[model samples]
Target: MGEVTTSLQRPVTNTGRSKLVRHVDSFEIQPPAPPSHNGVPRSAWARARRRVSRWHRPYITLLLLLDFAAAAVASLIAIETFDQSRAGFYNAEQDPTWFHTVAFGLLPLGWLVSLWANRAYDRRYLGLGPDEYKRVIRAGVAVAATVSFLAFATKTDLSRYTVGTALLAALLLILLNRMLCRFVLHVVRRNISQAGHRMVLIGTLPECLEVYTAVTRNPAAGLMPVAIHVTDGYAAAKGIETPVPVYAGRDVLALVREVGGDTIAVCGSASSEPGELRRLAWQLEGSGVDLVVAPQLTDIAGPRVHIRPIEGLPLLHVEEPTLSGPALLAKNLMDRVAAGFGLLLLAPVFLFIAIAIRISDPGPVFFRQPRVGHEGRTFRVWKFRTMYVNAEDRLASLVDRNETDGMLFKMKEDPRVFPVGRFLRASSLDELPQLINVLKGEMSLVGPRPLPADDGDFLGDVRRRLLVRPGMTGLWQVSGRSDLSWDEAVRLDLYYVDNWSLAYDLSILWRTVGVVLARKGAY
Candidate 1:
């Protein structure tokens, strides 16, 4: 018989209970207690830290207030725009009445309610990626559709222009407000101590390390790893060093409690059995802790993953990647229209670049290189001449000075690059000529970067990158450009391939503008 202890009037045992606790030989560690400060032993400090770390409520409330204010402002702007346009219209004689008051009041309320219905305020979707923005857009569309249906069915005297303008304004304002909020939150998180939820990672050493790297890299996501609970025998078999303490334990609930972690991230290798996970969830009930299970799937996006619980068993379904759907068709159409417009708008800039290149060195205005394109076909990828005419002849001599890894050759300050070429590369102006490639249907406004045709033999399975037309700027360009390792570049490209969406493309394009302005990771 093993000695047991009681916690909160419930017996804690190593076995024979709803929660299976198979204890190992690892020593138990207690959670951090309050320290004495100026003759005061403040035990409540730990609790207060935990409370502050859970910022979901306050964050959501702030967003709600911002949304309401945006709605009111947008409504006023829409009404003013409509009134100015319809100065002599028949409805101008109809004085402001209860209808106006009711409309103003109900529109914001409907917008708020729709956002809630779409789970826009959910903590899981907040502070990360484009999910929150997608939800907000969906909510706005839902409200617009509902309002249109009501007006059409009830024959209400409503201005379609006013309604449409107000909704669009509200959407843009809300997104802007949310972005500002995230920026402020990120600043606070970086400056403040104990700003994020304390998380205990449970998995094998490698798996735990992987999750730890991801969480630390995106500190804005608000998951701070306090400790790691490795699977039995992993620590002894393969020793590893981490910023946080590591323990070998089979009882996840006990480890979480000991570490005082409000979140438990179980990596793919930790809980292989579904029943074990279900039991752990049951034991964690009323514990005020969250359980996040990281699946084995890599490079897959949220939209492709679906979970269906049937007969008490959860089944994960992944949709295959396809580029022939209506979504891809819409993407293609947008690419052509935007690329054509960009070329027309920037024709003067193009001529200026051409003249600069001509004056800087006697060479063609545009440089063409054979690049692997969609379906492994080859195309002439065009760019403004950013190098000397004999750049290729000097390539072999500079191979030893290559700055980037694997098949790509990158040099921060190569002898073959002209003075004007450095400016072009630094500001990414040289790639502007690829807009023509996009317009000609050999590429897209957003996709994987086209690799040199000679490197095709090294791609292996990564040839999947050729499924869609290469892009002028892609995950590689926006993320780190010449600074990224070959593996990292491939990973990002595959991630984009696995999870391409119009919203994601728009997000990347927006980020690209900022990256270019900041001049980060560019040669």
Candidate 2:
């Protein structure tokens, strides 16, 4: 990712300044005539936008209805299960329908209100990231707090069982509903080309191409790059081929209109002018097109970034990574507790696996190898042996057959691995013994995957990964594992190191279950 140092006011250099100025001036002098529609509607793009708009509203409405239904059903089930007859402001004996009415109506309404207040239903959070889940959880807490406060204020004998059960069930149902909805949306976006925002990407050649690749790769994000408008005329003139149709940056609004693009994504260093983005926004004001600015910053999560407005300029402030203090302490505590619990609970499975390995081949059940750990420390990491005893000796002969690059070595079908080993590797069961490594505090349950002690002497930015304990599983494991390029794997590892949070760790752990089960990207 490119680092942004200069302000948005990065001056137009003299190299091609005059030629480009003349080129842009010519556009102002003689605007390209709009393509004659020959009586056809010019609102085709607008119609498509309206169609997408319609889709968004209906989907959100459906989510709302589902939430209401979930809350209502949860309330009903809780009250019925707990037999809260003598609860709430009015007792069931005094007014039989009073508690029922409140449970069925007020509880659901309050839940919806809490969700709305927390922006759980915001479009930005609808189908992606853990923010949606976080918001939902926050809404649940808000509802719980409200209930507790109301009960205390009114001196009502609210049934703890009923309230607790209702909130728990409602949150679960809502989260499940969101997951299903996201799955459906992903499928639709992947299969249907017209399902997402048709975007016109604006940037220099390299930046535009980078953003284009990212957008196209993640179909779940709903950003379809329809065209590219290069801000660097020299790069465009070099006849560099691009994935999307290229255009001059001077006529950006015209290009979007021609390409039916409903979104304009401005990638890194799109302009030399300080107010170019603001001007672009002004140009898009009445066009019903979204303007998105992609900063050079990458891999930094939202929680670490903040925008501070002074006068008319908005400055981006990034907080330093939380490498120490209460958060890391909490993470340490969580890792030890979870690792201890997992070891005890999975002892029988571990024993079974050891027996299988013994039967499959004559070698040690556990493979312990020296790995780089926190602060450049070396530790013996443990894993179930998934290769023959002579695997290391055969490595020299198979060096040319390595499928992956960089300090790592991988092969889809290594001759050294036994049949049972293949199964264990694919299912990631071989790594189960690393619970011991985690328990010993040599590794975390989530962080950068430790490299072999001889991978290479860590240097420069790569050395940052050693600041935290290596992990049994991490962002790289959940993302692509062996399928990822060496550089990409390193980048993911660095991202994990830089932006680690307990929530992020938990999310990775949750996704790791799915990734392992699906055997995606596993050797």
Candidate 3:
């Protein structure tokens, strides 16, 4: 729900919940008529949504710490705060018959064992969306339940204090860790997008148009699609309403030479003769543009697609994503750690920002906007108020000042910003409150920035950005900020998703410092 519109303008949220968004359905873009023997058929965009990492590590770590801390505190209170004999005992000591002193001291070990035994690390639903969080919560509950059932079944002496304390500690820890990871990733992505890498989307008329829309939607991807060109069914350079110009140059070789695209997406099948295709290859032989051809393989995945050179013709193999064993373990480990830390560090930041906002504005410092989070569920996103208390009442009058490229609004000098609000925005202090969002698990520190709930008129076929949590800072934040046009922003975001890596996060964070200090895109 937070974003940068353009230069000379700073557009903040000032609309009421009554304003609804224009949502688009995924109307599968179809290909040209039955493929003539003369040209290749249509292509499918099998792009995978980006999986945030690096930041996830802290989320995991924080969770572990919280769980341990909670257990320790609970044990102390149980052993001293309350009489141990009063609560039903479910003793876990084995043949060793450890003494009370050690048994009370052994809370940490018991808590660890319980955490592992319940498979809190096992994530049956990781990226399928909301189910992932649900699965983890269920697992936590199951672990606690198992311990309780075991204690009762055995009729052994057990400390109810120990079990409750351990469970509460683990839950709090995991949430804290997740929060930390979100911030790390956010900081990291900003750094990555600052690296100088632009993108050029190549495809058929329709496909290239879609690509243009993608590049305009997310700028944190670091790959700015400076220009979009169609490879077929068009003869001249055309504009596609993207932030960048759209050129429909049919000659691949000529386009490659003139436009000099860095990363080329062969969006759909082209009508070039084999000889033209060869010439295009020769022209691009040493040029660094990554020529990615998305063939007519719908429902295909990267794992299923392998490259093998048969003589000179490149072929691809496809495979299905398996859901089991190591994949599950790796995913679980990733989830727990990410969710854990995110909760801890953000806890304090959230407090400070909330207080700051309250000091400046009489209205609630935290403005909660219901946004579509993972899996289309609505979640309230947290942000600091930077506008007049009655800003929403004045939106209709300001609509004319809206410089909209697509679904976004750009107002160089908005009337709604209060005096202190400008500094908060320039320093990005306004976004500090979103750390609460990271804690809610509704957003990430780094990812595509979210869109306003009801502002989806011109976005057209570019709705995929909603597939993931909106980021606090992303490819666009470091690329050019408000200086970037809509096309450039989306290109960078799409590119980030296509070529995401842990290193990219590190890179984005470094660049973010430069952007902030220079105030390149800040208001």
Candidate with more favorable, higher lDDT: 1 or 3: 1
| Decreasing TM-score order of the candidates | 2, 1, 3
Positional deviation of residue 183's Cα in model 3 after best superposition, in angstroms: 25
TM-score of 1: 0.82
lDDT of 1: 0.78
Please provide, for model 2 over 141-229, each residue's C-alpha lDDT reduced to its tens digit, 9 standing for 90 to 100: 99999999988998888778778888999999999999999889988888885457888888887898888877776788888887777
> Which of 2 and 3 is the better model by TM-score?
2
TM-score to true structure, per model: 0.82, 0.85, 0.43
* Predicted structure with the largest TM-score when compared to the true one: 2
lDDT of 1 at 411: 86
lDDT at residue 226 of model 3 (Cα atoms): 54
* Model 3 residue 298 lDDT score: 42
- Tell me the deviation in Å of residue 270 in model 2: 2.6
List all candidate RMSDs to the true structure: 7.8, 7.7, 19.5
Tens-digit lDDT track of model 1 for 127-180 = 777788889999999988988888789776676777788889989998998899
Instruction: Provide the overall lDDT of each model, using Cα atoms, as 2-decimal numbers.
Output: 0.78, 0.81, 0.54
Clashes of 1: 0
Kindly indicate the candidate among 2 and 3 with the higher lDDT.
2
